[model samples]
Target chain A: MSKNSMKESYKIKDNYNTSIKIKSLVITLICLILTIICLLPIYLLVINATRNTSDILNGATLIPGNETLNNYKNLMALDGFNALTGFKNSFIISGSAALLSVFISALTAYALVVYDFKLRGPAFTFILAVLMIPTQVSAIGFVQFMIKIGFFNTYVPLIVPAMAAPSTVFFIRQFMKSSFPLDIVEAARIDGSSEFRTFLTIGIPLLKPAMSVQLIFAFIANWNNFFTPSLIITRTEKYTLPMMINTLSSDRYTDYGMVYMGIALSIVPLIVVYFILSKYIIEGVALGGVKE
Target chain B: MASNAQRRIKHVSYAKYGYFFIIPFFLVYFIFSFYPLVNTMRYSVEKNLSKEATIYDGEFVGLDNYKHILTSPDKNAEDYYVHAGMREGFLRALSNTFKIWVMNFFPQMILSMILAVWFTDAKLKIPAKGFFKVVMYMPNIITAASVAVLALKMFSNDSFSIVNNTLLNWGLIDEPIQFLADMKLKRTIIAGIQIWMWFGNTMILLMSGIAGINPSLFEAANIDGANSRQVFFRVTVPLLRPILLFTLVTSLIGGMQMFDIPYLFNPGTNRSPGTQTIAAFIYQIYMESRIKNTGHSGAASVVLFIITAALGSIVFYINRDKDEIAAKKQLKKLRKQAAKKAHGGLGL
Candidate 1:
């Protein structure tokens, strides 16, 4: 009876080991497949960006070609190919929007977290409710409002709307709740620091991580914003990177090579920004997930 | 007594300071956002078109515009004029939006969850996982219009498109597919592009959720002779429900507001009637009113706002109820387990 039991146990153990190996192999294969699928479109973008219109239409090669520089030159020579102006517009809009949003959101979060107020619950709930409303729902009204207020075709509409982002406020609030210690606030208060001063000097400094995340989020949102600009900005010279890229298709020449080049050029800044701030972006997204 | 008055003054000053700190955001919000929202709601009730129009000058439309847009058969036709009730174009756009939402949002969520689970599995040590993540997420950082443009090129019906070429080379089809031109194919391709752009964000969230799960729980399940599938279903899924729900709700809201993809895909030249979303439809009405010299675009905006708000609230409420039920079940389970342990000689 003992020998029979030992043999059965050995058989069971063997089955478990085999299954584990199989599961690992299966998962590994799946990951490989997904990674390839995810990377292919980007690879195609790069390849197409390098080739001339004819080569792009004829061949699909994985390697870098000699026509890359020529294609880029042709792209830059196109009408409305003001790379400098596009970059300037994008940077100004995205940077200003990010700074303003982070500041406002952080201050609001600070007040909600450190202060005792009668309307705190209602105020926070209001912000949360705003997060649920789609921005497009108000797109029409916002455009009309912009035109009425004489802010049409200007950066004010873009930068100002971002300041009241409920998502940023919510994120900053969560960060303050979890990461900011009450003892520090109390100590600051005991040291005769006013609430505003404490928030500005102490709270804001401590919120660097959250602020960084908010900056990236706000920047990305503003930078990628095409719908609002499309609706409001009709002037060719006022076009941001996205709006400029959209205008590429409007050209009668229809240079596929130049179009791809423009697409590639438009994405390069974001890729650079991502590489620099990826750590914060990942953490912000993770934290944002935790709250919802 | 003097010090007591000073303390009261100080308290009042602090309250004022709080208000001062919040004032900047309020100012911007009120001017750029809140006022627009209020104006939208107000405009929904009134009919005002001219520069001389006033709240009192405008006749109260009541809910007539909403009724006409929602219930009128004439409004539901594709080629119907924007001013002649609800147009058929608007209905087609609404349906396209919902189709894109279902096709893109759910698959993106599910695939993200699957990828997250696979990445977090202990047995699979995928090399360069971080690199792949960065690559996948790069598209997310790019402007949506640019991505749409790239998608346009890649899915072009021309001989250059990889999709068409591959299919033809593989003998899968005798002719190239017009991915963006045909209605069904257009929606699918657009949804595919959107999913490609967004899945990275979902994957990142799901990965974090999966990472938060305690390893010992899986170990305990393994000790009980549970298979991988069972462990995922019984342990991982229940714990990850909140994150999944969050993804679903956010995606649904985002999906409903989708405009850039369809807009960029169709552009102004193609004017593919079938590719218009409700947002695009609203934009079209606005354009027509501006160009054709009419004021009915305001009416269309009112209708669009109502549809978006109604749909958004319904989804939000449903998800909230589901979340509350799940929370209650978790609480009940904890309580029963506690009671059982209390009645026994030792804790489980």
Candidate 2:
């Protein structure tokens, strides 16, 4: 009787293992299909970028065509959609905002971490409080104020406000709370370094990992910012990538290839950069989420 | 003498430098963010609007903008149609925003929760996990402008459009559907795009939250004869409350500011009435409209702000460090007891 029961339990365990294996296989297949759905649009965007308007009108195709140069020439010739100018404007705004936000956020986080001041608690609390306030709330007043100060149609509104990125400050402060050691600041002080100099020299090096992550995120955010820039900038010459892309939707554009190429140009750099740093970017997002 | 040196060393204050380091942040915040927030409030109460070529900032109009936005227009007024139109527009936009957000959020939460659980499950043995995550998150990084235009092209009303052509080839229907003309379909497409862009992000976040849970708890659940579903509900969801709350609140705040996709999806000068969001409404009134009604837009901005602030405070309340607060209270009580003992049980 004991032998028979032991065999019965073994048979049950084998059945359960087989069922678990089947479930895992089914999940993998579903995930694979979802992955295809996720990437299909982008893949088609690239394929369509190389095809002519006639071919695009016929139907979607999985393969590319020979109209790559034609599409490039047409996109370049398109009015108010200068890819070069768009790239320059986007780069300038995103680069400046990223640098300003990361550096200032690091400095603010450094102060909060290293020094025991009376207002430190209040300051950190203030950062946390304002972290959830979306910029759309004050966009109208910001635009009017910019217009009043003769700062409209310029990069000032876009770049200068980035110095006060509460989210980046909050994230970096959380990062510093975990890993940054205060003994280095003391060591530098013992070596007779000025406080600012110590921050620049030693504090920054220690905070490089956090700073780089925030810098990338800030850059991506500013690069993709269309709402505020759309409100501020009116001139075609000052248009960012997104604004330039918006002009493509106007009824005049019948050339589907050129339009697709215009989009491809805007996203290709970001895709390439993402491919290289996806590990860091994904980790950064996970870190930000868990820390919250 | 050594103790004196140590005390002097400690007295060398770096607190002053803390203020110095933080000066630039505060200065810019005041000038840029704080000032504009207050200025927006001011504009909401003032008669700050333009008609035709005339820009008007005449005088304070106490609660007029709010009343116009919130209340129905009088039928006897000369511009009753315009007033009713604006009132209906605001309410519709508010409702539309809520509807689209709800459509996107519930499914997103459920899917992300399931995916997160699967990704974190030890027994799943999922293949190419990292690649799947990377591909899924790719949509989020793409420019919303491009995504919007891309979706527009794919779902364009013409038969030659990608979706229609594919459907026709598959013999799904006799006629190509007018996706753009139909308001319900348009809103669903927008919500679909939002879900596509955000579900991966939510999944990754929840995965991190789950990964933080102790493995021993899962083992204990297994040993207790609990099935997978039972383990999930009885153990996982309860411990995942804080992260789930954080996700919900942040997603709601973001949904309130939904603009780009819905705005750019329209092929015309104005956003479609069916899918106009609050942010889009505010933009059209303040910037795009011929009248440029700053008063209404500002009022709407304030309303949005109040709602966000209320939502944000919930997160703030949830994220308070309970352990630390309790520790502080205990220390205070002990200090009070010490003082009481020194005072001979409060004889004084």
Predicted complexes: DockQ each: 0.43, 0.65
Which stretches of candidate 2 lie above 4 Å from their native place?
Answer: A1-6, A289-292, B1-8, B51-56, B77-82, B321-327, B346-348
Model 1 over residues B242-279: C-alpha lDDT tens digits? Answer: 77776776676677678888888864356577778877
Colliding pairs, model 2: none
Model 1 residue A116 CA deviation (Å) reads: 0.5
TM-score of chain B of each: 0.76, 0.93
lDDT of 1 at A179: 86
- Kindly list the per-residue Cα lDDT of model 1 for residues A52-134, writing each as its tens digit: 87776665668766677887888778776666678789889989998988999899888877766666656666666565676
Which pairs clash in model 1? B75-B86, B77-B88, B78-B88, B78-B89
> What fnat does each of the candidate structures reach?
0.47, 0.67
Model 1's CAPRI class?
Answer: acceptable
Best by TM-score: 2
Return the top candidate by DockQ. 2
Candidate 2 has a TM-score of: 0.96
